[model samples]
Target: MTAYKSREEVPLNEKWNLEDIYPNLQSWEEDFKKVGNMIDDVKKFDGAIHGANDLYSYLSLGEELGMVYKKLYVYAMLQVDLDTRVTASQALLDRASQLGQKLSAATAFFNPFLLSLEEKTLQSWIEEVQGLKYFEDDLYELYRYKAHVLSKEKEEVLSQMGEAFSAPRNTFGMINNADIKFGDVTNKDGEKVELTRGMYSKLIEDDNRDTRIEAYKAYYKPYVQLQNTIASTLSAAIKNNVLMAKMRNYPTALEKSLFGDMVPKEVYDNLIKATKENIEPMHRYMKLRKDILQLDELRAYDIAVPLVKDVKQEISFDDAYDTMLKSLAPLGEEYVSTLRSFKEKRYFDVRETPGKRSGAYNLGLYGVHPFILLNHQDDLDSLFTLTHECGHGMHSYLSSKHQPQISAGYSIFVAEVASTVNEILLIRYLLKETEDKHMKKHLLNHFIDSFKGTMFTQVMFSEFEKITHEKSEQGEPLNAEVFNTIYEQLFRVFNGDELVFDDEVKFGWSRIPHFYRPFYVYKYATGYASAIHIADKLLEGDSDTLERYLTFLKSGSSDYPLELLKATGVDLTTPEPIQNALSIFSELVNEFAEL
Candidate 1:
């Protein structure tokens, strides 16, 4: 394997075109000042939004100001992620954050005031002001939460407390990413390699079982040591969620978290149910791994190692791009052409450089093209990661083009659907093209592993979150012991008796960062299920399904996520999507067994 490249050494074309956002710092500073000036202008219409003319003006100004805010904020954030060690870039990011808080405080009264208006009067204003029709859905979305909208003074207090509430998550990050040391472990090649969150994935996937076990133990040791502190931080975070939910009149923290994204509790519950019902397939997969690897007993660390060795292929970045475009051809020529344009335009930062952020994501700014950050490793996984981020880019492109700035962003509930759909398509294309039995088994392993990771593991985490929050609400002490016991039980339930776990597995909850964001992981499960169903339809050559899926992408936040998905023929509110996805998982497991 090649060593990672520095940012300066990477080819210019491989990096993202930050100039597309702004030519230089001076240009960004100009927009920064312009947005700062507009915050004051936005506040002028605070009390005047009651009238039809003022309402129209306020909406238009708010949209334009929002577009500028997104551009400034995204530019700074993308810059900072490129090299977080740069003080100037960090300062720019901080300035953007402060500006966001200022704008939020300045316009905090808009929602309360709008909700205060009688429905009849608001409707009359919408009819009288022709431009207000453009903001009809935006207004109605706010109105939907009228019952939850607090008084202006109270809302301001809550808004100001935002930074304080973020302490637990920040503390968790500092400990996990900066403080905790995993130490070094010797690999099977007799070389000492440092254990890290990023390295853990690669190590666990190694063909050598002893190497995986060593890395897993080393990687989780710090988490076990800091279990109490991590548990305390998580408890505080959960309490914050519960307090906020009560303040907003929500019955439960889960309900409060889901309500904001317009997701029903039934969706969360259904995912858990479907996962439980499908454990037999998971057990079968586990047995197959044990059989193929010729292990006496299957351990958690043994699960991720490839079943077929020497089948790993290194794919160049250019080949990955071509494969992605071909895999996504079901979306039509226009979609493929636009994706090709993104590649040519250098919309992606495609190399892992010193100080660059880990993982991959697509950052979508309102007034600029979506920017993708990737630490490309030139493997099948990297290829899939490229496709996933591009899915997000395409989604953002379509939404921004079709909707107003005010409604261009989609909910997190449906955000993962487009990305996971691309992965499914790419996997199908590879499976069809590969003729080697070992290669086919490797691809099948990838598919099963993805299902287990996204669907099974996330749902397991979601269940753990639900139980812990419920216990905390019931006044149970949320110390390390309490958390470990709950986590161990859930692990047993999910993994069944076929698999064995080390003691360190109990502290696994302490390592997961998503616990800070209550009830968020379930969306990964729901999104995967939705993506599977949609990908299956499109792959079956349903032209109308592709059209509907594209429309779903462009719909953005104009409708509730459930409604948007329903329009795309996937009703997440029901259990059918989850069951269908699991059925596909079962079929894939059988295929892998035969291979």
Candidate 2:
């Protein structure tokens, strides 16, 4: 009963205007050309930062140019994402990517300049120049990586080559979202339904198992046919990781990944170890699913359904936003007031449309406000999603207001904390407010499922990614047969004996776009862990915890992400965060059992 077309057919209202970024493409283009011209100007001060005065001027100029580049990049990117079909938008994206490379190349001297200065000299510069006070922590963080930073030329080469280096990921995304087709599925009413990715999700989450299975199979059929292409993309991505690690003189890809966040190797290893030890919870859940559904066996398609059914409820977008405000009130009045503006201002693109990118994310940039992309539907799930993204928006709002623009962008390691914390708070808020047993059970299922997806499943993915890279390091060729065997083994490992591993499920990796992102999924697990810990602290209603949490949000990239997290009481470098998160998972499972 729904009519659909590409997003351009129903463009967003001006209410979601990005004119704050730039007035128009012409102005953006003008700024882009100005950036190209400023390349030479930046090169002049490269090797001449000798005295404190020179360093101050260099730092201030660098910050100003950085603000310019930030505005240009966010504008072009927002335009491209809004209507990806326009060739002009695609061209702008290409230009913006290239310009970003140029900007990085130009700014390469900042790190080396600081690295060259003795600690006392750097301190002298901070004291002598008031402008540099805001960025003292930023410079200190960069200096922490002085041992890892390569020669300026090598870093510049890496920066310029990054776009080409990330092509495999881009190709996989293009194929999966735009090119591949999932035919159609027969619905409960005997009507044939087209199996677009959006529709596929709706069908899989349906209360009917038959609809879930058929939709899952039909949806993945195209990926099965394109296995070779998918394998090639995976191979290229893995190879890129190995190549980059070697070039950077790191022992392995994992070291390079951990180094960026100042996370020790033990952090990654501990998550894998902790998940392996406690994986039975996931397996037990699978067994519970089989018993609940009265099935002889389960398959990959069965992974998404509720253990207790007939619990679905419809929630509208307006109601969802209102509920988010109610749930977030525990954080105090200022946080609640800012969240209200984001909701009323159309700060989010809240509905799914044809040709729109899938999933949700909060994009932050200097000077411009944070933007969130969401494929929202008016359900309890979507309401939780709204609360989640608003958490991110609010975090970005605070950081931008409290920190220098250069340090306002948070590291990915801690990025998920605010968003997931919002979800936790909302779940607790709803559970406290509702009296109906079904709604209570429904909310509990939602919380349990969040842990299952964000913590457990992503860790499984992190393991898969680690194993894939290790095999690639050992010179094993990543092809259809080899990759399928590995994928099947992981399925068995994660699903235990309860769920049968169907051969069709091997092609599932091809459908995932995140694998192309180097070691990114693990952050989702770490983020949730940090969020839950922070949420518990905030719920205590202690001023110190509240102030510390806010300070952590505003800390941004002022320090290594783990060090910043330590200030907030979550030590990602240790096993405790993962263990704590998993303990909550176990408790949720037991609670669900009692309910």
Candidate 3:
């Protein structure tokens, strides 16, 4: 085994080329100060809007300021995201966020002013202003939420108080995930492994049961010790959601979140119901794991081991690039050509090194092409991550090319669909092309692992979130004991009679950052289910389906997510998509067992 080299050891030119965003930090600082000065100019928008014409001028000036602000903020955020520990980058991020808040407060009148328009008058003005054409849909969306729009002064207060109001959640993020300390664990070979959160996650996925158990216990002891404070932090965060919902006059915070995406409540409920009903496949798969590993019993820690380890395959970064291009061919030559450009342009930061972001993501800007951030280690997981993030990059590339800047950015509801679609397509391609039986079996197992994690497990977490939110709404104190109880039950439902849900796993909710965003985890389950349906269409070589899916990708915020998805022949409002995914999971489970 080799000790991985830290990023400092890697040549700077081969690393993240921040030169693409800015030539150097000094230039970035100059732009940062320019953006700071521009914020003062945005203050002019506060008193400019008195009517539709006034609103048009105000909006034009605001958009220009916003474009520059976006450029500055994106650079800062991308730099921070690449490695969050950089002190100067972190300071820039804070300043950018503060500037954003100030600008948002200044522009708060635009919506209320638009709401003041008579329906016919607003409609006429909408047609009259050529500058408003690209924003027609967003303006209409604002109109749709007119009833919920607070008075300008109240809205401005909310905007100004934004950073202060969310302090507890931010506090939790700092201490829990970033700076927490946990005990070290001894690996199978008797070497001490210092267990950071990232290392703990990778360790628990190890094939050795003892290594996983040791990692889990050592990693969580610190969280379990401070469970009360963690509970209070999360409780404060949840209460803030409830408070904001009440202030906005929404029925609930869940309603507030779903409305932003124009997602129906049924979409959430159906995901919960479909996943609960279909959890047997996951349970059966877990049982299979226990038997295959020849363990007396299965533990939560053993969930990530390969079912057949002797069939090993490793992919390098270059091989991954070529393989991804081939796997994406079903999306058409135009799509493949853009991916080729992404490769040639060195648009990806593809390697694992200290202090870099742990997971992988693709970030894109309006005027710029997408860039992917990864901690790649040439494993199956990293390969999947490359394709997944590429899905996002390609989606961004197409959307930016097709839609205007404002509408070019998409809602989070449909965000995961394209990525998962690529993952499914990639798996299908691998299985079809491989001649090795063991490798094929491993591929099938890999796909099953994806279904298990993204669909079944995420839906379970979503249910837990709903339960906790409902409990909090009833004024129940979300102490560790209560939180643990709810988590234990959900785990039992997903894990079934096969394994025990130790009390420690109850504190697991505290470890999941996604829970901080109310009702967010459900998207992963919905994304997985929806992607399967779209992948099936594309796999059958249906050009029309490809066209519709591409249209959905380019739609951005123009249409409701359900409407956009329906154009691709999948209605997330119904349970069909989730059920379809469950059926496919069943098929894959059976196929893997046979293999």
Candidate 4:
């Protein structure tokens, strides 16, 4: 993998074609001004809604303006993500953000107004206006939050405070992506150099214990040093969530976060509960790590190294993409071919550069194509990541293609199912294709580690989020010390007593970007379980399963996430899905032990 010193040095084919969104600053500026005018137009309807025609007018205009506004914001936001250190890009994004807040405040009256209407009046309006049919379902969905919705005035006030509510996340984004720097470590040439996230990924799994140790400490040094600062931002974020939950009349922050997805607290509760009841496999795997590595002590750094060290695989971006397409052939020719075109069309920003965001993600702009961001290193793990994100990309692409803008975006609750299904397919493909025993063992280890990361680790994080948010809700003080204690305790419970804790391990809570998004990680755990079932069925070549799964992707937010997954034959309301995933993990662990 080439180390790109700047975004310009990366190949054009490897970067996004932002021109797909906006051709130039002039075009972006025109859209910005147009959105401002549209915001003004929409705001005029605030005190004016009286009947069917008025409601239809407001809804249609508001939706149109929102579509344009999304393009403006995405174009600006994507540039900032490309190189976060750029002040001009930052300014552009700020403008877009403030515009979004204005749009939010402008439309805040709609929800409360809709909820205030009687069910009969709402139904009568839908009967009266043909165009209102486009927005009928969404308008009725407001009834679900009728108890939670505040007075129009208060809702407007809260909407105007959107940026204030998001400040901590924004501050942390700057800190994590653009400000914080990792310490130095000795590289292959025996010279010390400052570590980047890309480099740390490789170094952490180095065959040399000393190298892994050095990289681990150095990678964590900055996070530990800034622990209190990160803690402050995190505390503020959690407090903000709890505050919003209270203002919304929720029983708790967790419940409030789950409300949007229509996911019951039991689904959240059962995920953690089921995982803990089945956690012995995880502990057993940790002990297996110690035995296979022949170490008296296993640290957190020792956990990621491949137990099957005799096999090493290095995959370049091109090969990874080709392999990803091959693995996904089970999805069908159209699915494979469309995903192939996403690469040829430069849908991906594929290399790491200075000041780039550290991880991979797929952002689907409704009217535009899916833009995937990856800091891809040439390795097997990167191959999984490529497949993982393409799963998200395909979901985004299909969702936008099949549904109206209102229903085109899928819920976060089911988002991971798409991505993890892709990963399972890729790993299963590798497992089936490889003839060598060493390679198969490595693949098995990779699969086990992926399970640990996606399911177990996320469940651990879900529990951490739960505990921390509960503490805040209970009026407990949360600082660096409190975070450290909770995190270290969770780590010990999840990983078992086989490994000694590093001081840096306690500071693990400080590094996650996901915690900023409340009650979100649990979806990843749930999605992984749901994907395991769906992927296994697809592998069996069931045409009905394949069609339903594909439709589930295209269906997007047209239905609740659980209902969507249920259509694909994976139900999360019961513990069966989580338990089934755990069973697979246990079987894999035992299979590896015998090897």
Candidate 5:
């Protein structure tokens, strides 16, 4: 395998073409100034929502400001991610973030003012004003929250106080990502390997049980020591959620969070219920792992290791690109061609370099092509990750192409669908093409792992969030003891008697940063479930199915996520999709067991 390269060492073609967004730092600064001026320009129309003409002008100006702000923020953040150690880049990102907050505060009056307007009056304006007609969906969406929106003064206060409200999550990031240290563990070769958050996934997957155990313990040590601090931080976050929910007149934080996406609480409840009903498949898979590994007893750390040995396949970047394009062929020539065009245009920052951000994501801007960041390792996992993120890129590409600036960005509720769909397609393609028994088993294991991580594991986290929030609402203190007890019980319930939990397992919640974003993790489960159903239809070579899925991607935030998904023939309101995904998981487990 090739060694890691610095950004300077990586060839130009292998890096993302950020120049497309801004030609140089001078260009970026010019846009930054433009955003500041636009922020001031927007405040002039603060009280202008009374008439049709003012409303049109206000909406038009808001859209323009939004477009410019998104470009500025995306560019700054992307630059920072390229090399976080650069002080200048960090300063640029901070400036952009501050500008964003200023814009938010400036626009706070718009929602409250819109809510003040009578529905009949707003409808009349939409009909009479030509410019307002373009934002019909935007206007309707604003009206949907009329009940939840506060008075103009209150809304402005909330908007201005947004940074303060985010203190818990911000502090959590500092402690979890910056301060906490996981120390080191001895590898199978008897060399000491430093353990970090990024290494946990790969470490847990090591074939050596001893290495996994050591790493798991080492990683959880700091978390356990700081459990009290972490618990307090989480409690504060929950309180923030509860406070916001109460202020919005929503009965619960989950309702308040899901309301924005138009997702009903039943969807969340149905996912947990469905997963609980389908827990047997996961238990069986766990038992299979124990049997295959011939372990006298399975521990939490043992679950991630592969059942099939000697199946580690390293895929090159070029090979991964070609495979991703081929795997997506079910979406037809146009989809494949668009993705291929991205590859040819150097859309991805494809290698890990010093000071570069870890993990993978597709950063989409309104007017420019989507940019993908990847710390690409030469393995099957990296290959699938590339496909998954490219799935997001394609979704963004299509959405931006088809929708207006206001509605182009999709919601978190449906964000993971396209990405997971791409992963499923990639797995299917790999399985069909590979004749090697071990490789096939590896692919099957990969499918099982994906379901476990995205579906079962995320649902488990979802349940934790739900229970904790409910507890907080009930006036139960969320200290370390309470938090640990809750987490331990849920872990045992999900894993069953097949796996053993060390004491360190209690601190696992401390490390999961997703808890900071309450009720956000469950969408991964829903998205995966939806993707499984959609992938099956598209893989069947049905042209209409393919077209509907494409249309769903392009719909963006124009409609509610659930409705858009329904159009794509995946109804998330029901538990059927989750059940279907679980059935697929069971089938894969059975296949892996046979192999």
Candidate 6:
């Protein structure tokens, strides 16, 4: 709730203790130098690897280098995200990134060389070396990409271009985080101030209709002004994915993205199909929103405003943390206690300040702790965001603690389930705990809105990604107009005909940073559905589900994401989870209407 003029202005408790990572810049440099030497040492194994001992040596060296690389990259990344405008941190990240490209290039030959060996020979070698048994599963997994693995020479070349491959994403990150500026808005003091993402967040939901309209237009102005530029960046990113998929012999770009998790292309397509088939509830909710707001027409900004405006509660950060902990008691004391320690240990960068990255995320370093970035506004929405990210942090923490370094990290697919499960639990607890009907109704509205944002909107983005990527594969030109047209069309289709269109609405794709990641947003929807199922079971006191779910968290990438999720009795390969979630949404809308 307090304004922070600079990163220094934020309390030490609210800021991250990066010293936990490096202790000092000298240590970071030492690790950077260490990685460089390891990269050189790793390159020596290229042609020299002959038998089991050579293979063991290469794999072990690569694994150690990987641990160091993660620490370096994560430390630099946390620095830049805390304050993007710091050139020193930017330089550190740049050095770390270049170091990563070198590491990638050095090891790129290993994969190609790996697939070159006959399965029988590799198995014999695995039988020959005991250390290799540690890497047996991952080593065998490379065979899954046998057809996709390029020649050693080509792999090396591609790996050298790692920075270039990520250029568009980095460019967009700078634009979104450091360079672009929102238009001015009138603050509570009746002074015109430059609008920030943190300010726009609250202003867009202002009770004053005129203020909301002003904030909405102002918030979108910069994005609209730079639409063509952003369109070009996004177009490049999509084309790059298409090219990578083609080069790797994938049938489609979407399939290429899914291949890592061994998820069937049908799963991706089915998610979209099932959601569209059951989309009437979503459309009905929009109409309900229109009526509840008493508006002749709903607009883009109106979508996020709470329908139950009179039942506002000003929850502070400590209160929000306490509420989140109490709400998560169903997960057992260990989970709740571990989460509380994360706050006490300064693992979170909790305040929004000048040039800090907008939005919230939890990044878990396998060896280090999970660093969560939040722009806390000390309101109900912030409470939900806190619980959501803590889910991810707990997942990261538990997985790292329980699993080996190799399997400690999780895929994006299973990652969302952990976070969304926490969110649903928090909402369920709040809904049951509230004594006032008005407050309960407000909580219900919050749940539905969160559901809409997480499930429906992400599916819409997934489709948008699908369509645009297909356009690139078909050799159609992608530019500002094309992107705007596709986005506006999808927006209308998903939200139904109840809303009026604005110019700012069409440019929505230009503003989403996730679009740069290529075919990644659909997991949010799928995970939301999966979380709904898991959270409901937990609410019913299904101890078996809780134990399996906890084990699922610690399992990490030990198995494919789907297998991990299936182990918890939520099979995303089937339609039941999504349908169950949609049914719940319909029920919530009905209950909300009754209220």
Per-residue lDDT over 1-595 for candidate 1, one digit per residue giving the tens place of the 0 to 100 score: 4556468888888898898988999998999999989999998987776589999888788888888888888889898889866889889988998898888888888889999999899999999988999888778888889888899888877777777788899899768755777899886678887775566778898987778888988988888888888988999999898888889888898998988777778888888987898889988888888888888888889888888889778899999999999999998999999999998989999987766767889988777889999988888889999999999999999999998777799888888999999999999999999888788989999999989989999999999999998987887888899999989998888877778878887888998888998898898889999999899899999988999999998987888888988998988878999999999999999999987
C-alpha RMSD by candidate, in order: 1.8, 2.5, 2.0, 0.9, 1.8, 1.0
Model 1: residues with Cα > 4 Å off, grouped in runs: 187-189
**lDDT string, candidate 5, 310-398, tens digits:** 87777899999999999999998999999988878989998877667768899888889899998887888899899999999999999
Give me candidate 6's TM-score against the actual structure. 0.99
Q: lDDT by residue for model 2 over 1-595, one digit each (tens)?
A: 2234555544454125677677877888788888777776777788888777777777777777777877887777766666556678778888888887888778776676678779988898789878777767767877767777788777777887878888898888778767888998997789997877667767887877788888988988888999998899889999999988888778899888888677888888888898888887777877877887788888878877766677776777778888899888768798888888875666777667666677877887666678888777667777888888888888888888887777788878888888888899888888889998877877777788888888877887898889889998999888878878877787788779988877788776777788988788888898998888888777777678777877887777777788888888888877888888888888877777788
Candidate 5 achieves a global lDDT of 0.87
Give me candidate 1's TM-score against the actual structure.
0.96
Record all residue pairs in model 2 with backbone atoms less than 3 Å apart, i.e. clashing: none
Q: Is candidate 5 or candidate 6 better by lDDT?
A: 6
Cα lDDT computed for each candidate against the true fold? 0.87, 0.79, 0.81, 0.93, 0.87, 0.91
TM-score of each: 0.96, 0.93, 0.95, 0.99, 0.96, 0.99
lDDT per residue (tens digit) for residues 97-205 in model 4: 9999999998999888888788999899899988888998898788989999999999999999999999999999888888788878999999999899889888999
- Sorted on lDDT, highest at the top, how do the candidates line up? 4, 6, 1, 5, 3, 2
Global local distance difference test of model 1 = 0.87
On the 0 to 100 scale, the lDDT of residue 540 in model 4 is: 97
State which candidate, 1 or 3, has the greater lDDT. Answer: 1
Q: Which ten residues in a row have the lowest lDDT in candidate 5?
A: 193-202
Angstrom error of the Cα, residue 486, model 4: value is 0.9
Q: Write the per-residue lDDT of candidate 3 for residues 1-595, one digit (tens) a residue.
A: 1235566665453466667777887886787778667666666766565555766776676677877788778888877776667898889889888888887887776677778778788778778877766667767778888778898888889998889777877888777646777877886678886776556656877777778888888888888988888888888888888888889888888888898888888889988988888888888888888888888877777777788777645777778878988998999898888888887777787765655666778887778678788777676777899999998988888889988777788867888998999999999999999998988988998999988889888988888878878887888888888888888888888887878565577777878778778888888889889999999899999999999988888777677778888899998877888898899999998988888
Backbone clashes in model 6, listed as residue pairs: none
What is model 1's C-alpha RMSD?
A: 1.8
415-476 per-residue lDDT for model 6 (tens digits):
99999999999999999998999998888888988988998899999999999999999999
